[model samples]
Target: MLPADGSGPTLAIRAVAAADLAALLDSLPPAAATFARASGFEAAAGSHLVVPEASGGIGSVLFGLGKGSDAASPFLIGKLSTLLPAGDYRFESGVADETLAALAWALGAYRFRRYKRGGEGGDGPVARLKLGPTVDRARLESQIAAITGVRDLVNTPANDLGPAELAAAAAEMAGSAGASFRVLAGDDLAAGFPLIQAVGQGSDRAPRLIDLVWGDPDHPKVTLVGKGVCFDTGGLDIKPDTNMLLMKKDMGGAANVLGLARMIVDARLPVRLRVLIPAVENAISGRAFRPSDVFPSRKGLTVEIGNTDAEGRLVLADALALADEEAPDLIVDMATLTGAARVALGPDVPPFYTDDDGFAAELAAASAAVHDPLWRLPLWMPYAPMLESKIADTNNIGSGGFAGSIIAALFLKKFVERARTWVHLDIYAWNPSPKPGRPDGGEAQGIRALFAAIEKRYAGA
Candidate 1:
């Protein structure tokens, strides 16, 4: 949505609050001000008033900031990108966060039209934002591309984006960035990633461990692990039809890490980057591993399958174990692992857990700075007992339903021992409803904040 050339005649978008409406009206042309007043525009949040030019064509637009805290949101301006007609536009006033406002504009302009028939998906020209020189054009563009890629990947259906396709996507990205790409599947997967293999064996589609490595080997190591469950039919346990509807986004964790990896590689961040994704489909068949089955993880921990539906953490356990082997400076794993996380923090804000307070603080600041909502949840070692299994070292799920998100994080923590710092992001990855910059579909949640934190820690190293 960012246009490189700002030479054309562009409409100015002025921000106005309820208290500032009178001042804005006084500044506008007489006819435009009269029309605005006649329209009864109160400058409410997400509300907009278009002013007409002397020639009756569109002139400047006044966007509502509402009152109080809503006025400070950086993404509030994102609404204009979709609301306005096709043309170039620029902000006439300052926003809370100019960089994020620009980012939001581009994000808001995104439309997933892959499966839409001609003329059905709003294929018309889109409104473009003329970014100011103060913004980092390259960084903003890279973030947009990366986040858009996440949305696209998560939006794809299971049949089209199975483990094989997911691995191919990672390989393509790695090749483009000059990173080393490897896949462990078939016999190799069974031999190495037992947990990843156990979870995907139910589906006809094979399971794979996708590995991508880049940057200087001597630099500080940062490992990212994402759960790539292409589809979760809940295995033999099965899910209700309503629950199964959005299974296509089960791989959202993988999509996010790939997005974050793209930003890091594109920016040429000075750290050794390793991305490990366990791509699988938790389908049902005779080959599916049943409940109470025990699987040896890559980390050598025996995990009892308490429920087949809790498959995300199983695959992630193997990948996280592999990631921890090198004892990277930081190990961050993102997964749509539990409904408890959604219940606790909702879909917009994901909950993250980390034992390292310094890293947590940095992440918290980054989250606030970028407007990527992330709430830090305690690891809660006292709840670790809930994962105790009679037959195995641990159970895939907690003993009861209490603190499910924390329990899942604790289970993952069992696999990660050597990392200097480890963070787990329990993300929903889907927007149930449209808001400002975020649309009603797959979303890139914690990566923006994670990228900011990682860049701050290792940019010059």
Candidate 2:
């Protein structure tokens, strides 16, 4: 489980709704009232005010809960930590939604300072919270740690987190979990993952397949395959400058899988787990794979490249094939596969694909229970012909526009044949702006809901 700092001073907290502001403030001591008025504090949503004591020392922190009628944002209270002065704080009174508030507060304490100058954010609060039975602190901490890990991996610039680096990170995580870790890089990756090798051949960093295995061999098998395109320049079909800027986050699917793995491993779930990350950098060079090129995937299917920019599915197809060969009880593949997905569903809500009705229903319920929503887009077979190839078994891209996201899912679906259940998530993984518990930059998508479903499904296994 994730660790929390539990060592600071505890300050009483009074959460107030905008309408109840005057009544609540009137109940406070005269000096505390004066301080709030002096500060011109309005009980706006997400607004907070720290009242001072008669001795000029720190007093209670009055937090705003917004208008009483509107539905509260789950993470609205996340600002309590960093926004408040560094210390340990505890809620003075109980609230209806204690779990959401506590979790939000913990999530807001995240700091990504990998490339920051020596001392920046050094003095930031190591915000600690003491919560009551409303929130399970240990479980919440583990979730926070997993989410933060995903953000850290996605936030790191491509220079420090290429193919080998991404694999090394996963290896370290698996090592700590006592899981066996293996990697096939360079020439070794060529034989088993041809499409992976083709897309990554342009970069100096060697493309690698990272494999992690854990739990009893006889347990029900669960496999996770993530597209680890560390940085995508679109190969010979290079993207424009603005498009290339956030390419570092292209490997977000891989980051997310590792995050989910952390949660499972830490909880000691009763299932055999296997994680496959085909780490690579799709760069531009003399030997870069080109449009119209055909490559044999691990499934032995010939894939014609319609667009080099669509390299994510190529790597995933090969990795998914290997996972299928194992005939796992469940296989889930995640990737930042298509902009069409973003165009259709936007950034926050990701679209998912799965043929199994039972698994799809389970995912929907789990997503709702955890507030990590995913839209079920059709795996419409009519779009199947859109991935036609004149001389090969299939095309990496569809015929044209319209349903591009679905087409990509269909293309990937061609690779897996034996898994008992399979699901694919097309995630944005990048948050555009800071909002409550979620800060700007890399964010984890759907993993919480996915974890909930997995834990429930294999509970007695």
* Top model number, lDDT: 1
lDDT of each: 0.91, 0.87
Candidate 1 to truth, TM: 0.97
lDDT, candidate 1, 327-424, per-residue tens: 89999999989999999988889999999999999999999988899999999999999999999999999987899999999999999999999999
For candidate 2, give the lDDT.
0.87
The 10-residue segment with the lowest total lDDT in model 2: 1-10
lDDT computed for candidate 1: 0.91
Clashes of each: 0, 0
Off by over 4 Å in 2: 1-9, 30-42, 68-71, 119-121, 124-126
TM-score of 2: 0.93
How close is every model to the real structure, measured as TM-score? 0.97, 0.93
lDDT of 2 at 242: 96
